[model samples]
Target: MAKPLVKRAIRGATVNTGSRRFNLPEREADGDWLDAQGEIDGAPAPLRTSVTVETPRTIITRNSSPDVFFDRSINPYRGCEHGCIYCFARPTHAYHDLSPGLDFESRLFAKPQAAELLRAELRKPGYVVAPIALGTNTDPYQPIERDWRITRAIIEVLAETRHPLTITTKSDRVTRDIDLLSAMAAEGLAGVAMSITSLDPTIAATIEPRAPHPERRLRAVRMLADAGIPVYVSIAPVIPSITDHELEHLVERAAEAGAKSCFFIPVRLPHEVAPLFRAWLDAHFPDRAGKVMAIIQSLRGGRDNDPDFFTRMQGAGPWAELMRTRFRIACRKHGLGNRGAPLRTDLFRPPAGPQGELF
Candidate 1:
């Protein structure tokens, strides 16, 4: 009489499970909207992604976490369309009364006024000139970006003001703004990090259903590097059994593509992301699901996640040590040192308006 485990993937338009309950792990709870809707009664209707305008009063977000690198960041979008099952940002959607499962990918919010808001903040009399990070919460170049162009507009403002900026993304689309980024790099005002989790296309597709292909991302690194932009390759959220095996090969590939540095983090499963990732493992790698979680726990100090300041970013224990050792060896083998230079705050010029106009 019990419902079966889920087979729903991160991306799909329809579902058909006759005479059985579709046990979506993240939404199986009693108060979940998936169960409340009961829309799966017949042939599942097509699920489409929707974007809503988010008109927040401000744009720059301040961070004080010692573990985090940047003090201020900006998120042009709320929910990511990349659909990476291991995204730590997934839990943020709960504030909007939305599921971190399907809704996080399908229902999105964009700040169309991000550029204008950023200019106003920059024009403030006491504003600081530290580098602003993009793609910290959600990928700025996610698929919807092609049409929205909000990220582009923000970059335009940064370039116009000669503000220092750093970008992290998984899309080759970053190359589309090579003109701005390369110009910024000339003044030592910009840097970029491209995350390449897996070299095998199948694994990349399974985990990040909507992200650009691994090969394309590598090529993007090449293009960015060739443009004189400092390129750092990040093997972020390294899943234990799923992606750990590719750590060395991914490093090699990234180095071949002209990465100036390489780094990695063990997977993080805070809040709702844990259940969703577990369900994804059940659906995709049923044979190795238990083993994966076990190793993750070992790295995370016997819990599914460790939210401590320093320990969260770099896991502890024997497993974490082994990963660090391996990563060190790989970076050495590929001649990729942690060499990304700090962006130049000295070159920053405030936007030409308001409080900054007379400066």
Candidate 2:
């Protein structure tokens, strides 16, 4: 009387489940099965990615976090396809009644009217111009950007108004918008930061299954810098004993490839990220899992994370200090951290429309 439930397995995919709990009272499948078909033809069906559309009334999201560099941001998408196990944004998927684990990667949401809403917001007479940030909440240039193009549309609007913007992403697809970003950079209106976690291709493939290879990201830094766009390389969430070993090498390679600035954040295991990261460690580095978590806890003040405003980004105590010292020395040795130019806001001109056009 009911349709058969089929399960699919995708190579290189990280998350394992298909559905999750919801806030509302609803029926759910229990894990009690008697006898079931395990496989059909000795191979599993391919898991296909799915996307949903969200039309919101506004586009600009402003926050007042002391640790962050930007106050306002725009996320064209609601989930990242990269499937990094340590992503801090993963838990947000729980608000949608989805698993922060698998659904955060396979089930996605896109804002088709993001550019239109941004244009409307910018055209308000009382609006003030500042550098709008992208890829802050969820990466804007994930694989889906090739089809949805919401991020590109938003950039087009910003380019038209000469509005300042900054982007952070792990995908090389950003190079596709070089023409738009370069023109804005020429006027001091745009900049970009690329995240490179590890130089070992094996580690990278296991941790960031769908993200661009580390080398490709390095090449992207060079490409953007060569085109006059200021580029910063981030060695974010330095996993203890996993990715931390490549700290100096990562910064050195990025600097050689044209990065003018660098930033690093020691791993933070907030909320659901902790269990997910533990599972990842058990799967990838079972032998060293306990040691790795112990070191992370030492940096986190005997806990999995430190949520304090000032200490959250950089952590605290001696272990954190060691990372800071290492990062500072490496950055200095590579001739980085001298980029001081700020994105200009004086060049912004609102679109001609009923919201702001001259009478």
Candidate 3:
């Protein structure tokens, strides 16, 4: 009989602890212990269990960054388990003593007090009314949201106050709040952008492991549209040499699905995301790695990434020009709106409160 394969948990080495470490191991082929060691014997490393934590903090982060479209945003959770290698938000995990690679997708933090904090912030005297952006940092509708319901609670507060809000997500789970969203849309208080990276299921599975399937996202777009909500199709971070070819096709499909507007952005590899993306490419598509990066650099002014304002979102150079031209042509061909039409902000009405309340 063949021996069973042993599985072990991998952990980071402690500071100044030599090259030796300890880990528990078990068989892979069968649920049995093969060996136990307190010290390293030049064997493989072990894997660790995923840890989830709950955090209490104020919601509604204010941002003055000129690049962002919104002045304020809300994120119900930290650390996305969707595990997209190209996620620019991955670096945030380092602040929590976690790896931006595997740990980013496993370790998660949920804000249970988000609704209360939002209510308090809204009730403040000086709070200004603007369209609050949701899922700006981490997706508010991630799988854990099913139980936390933090996103829903925040939405409830916003709805009660008639605050204008916008949501961007890659999950079909957002459909659960369609009734509220549709009502808000009727009052010009809400809009949604469904991010569809690729129509190919295989590529989607590899790039966004835990996100809803592409077909499902398309269905979500249709549902939102049918509910009288403004729906936009976002083909974000269009990976060059990879999913770039699918731009026009994706736009056509989204248009058919009732999306009124379409947008696309060249890929970005900011911070630690660069290394993580490179690792993922090497693991999944080694043969096309160099070609893929080469195309990205072409768009990014001969660099791995371009962080310049105005240029970052749309890139420069010939490759950038080609992508822009293609997108424009696609939008025209499909009758999609030129760019996302700006949501109404002038119509916002602050929640009713005391006469002396701060504005």
* Decoy 3 TM-score against native: 0.84
Candidate 3 residue 4 Cα shift, in angstroms, is: 19
**Model 2 ranges off by over 4 Å:** 1-44, 354-359
User: What local lDDT score does residue 293 receive in model 1, on the 0 to 100 scale?
Assistant: 97
lDDT (10s digit) by residue, model 2, range 149-262:
999999999999999999999999999999999999999999999999998988887888889899999999999999999899988979888989899999899889998888
What is the lDDT for 48 in model 2?
62
State which candidate has the highest lDDT: 1
- Candidate 1 structure lDDT: 0.86
- Residue pairs with backbone overlap in model 2: none
lDDT value for model 3: 0.78
Q: After superposition, how far is residue 38 of candidate 3 from its true place, in Å?
A: 20
lDDT of 3 at 223: 98
Better of 2 and 3 by lDDT: 2
lDDT of each prediction vs. the true structure?
0.86, 0.84, 0.78
Candidate numbers sorted by lDDT from highest down: 1, 2, 3
Per-prediction TM-score to the true structure, in the order listed = 0.90, 0.90, 0.84
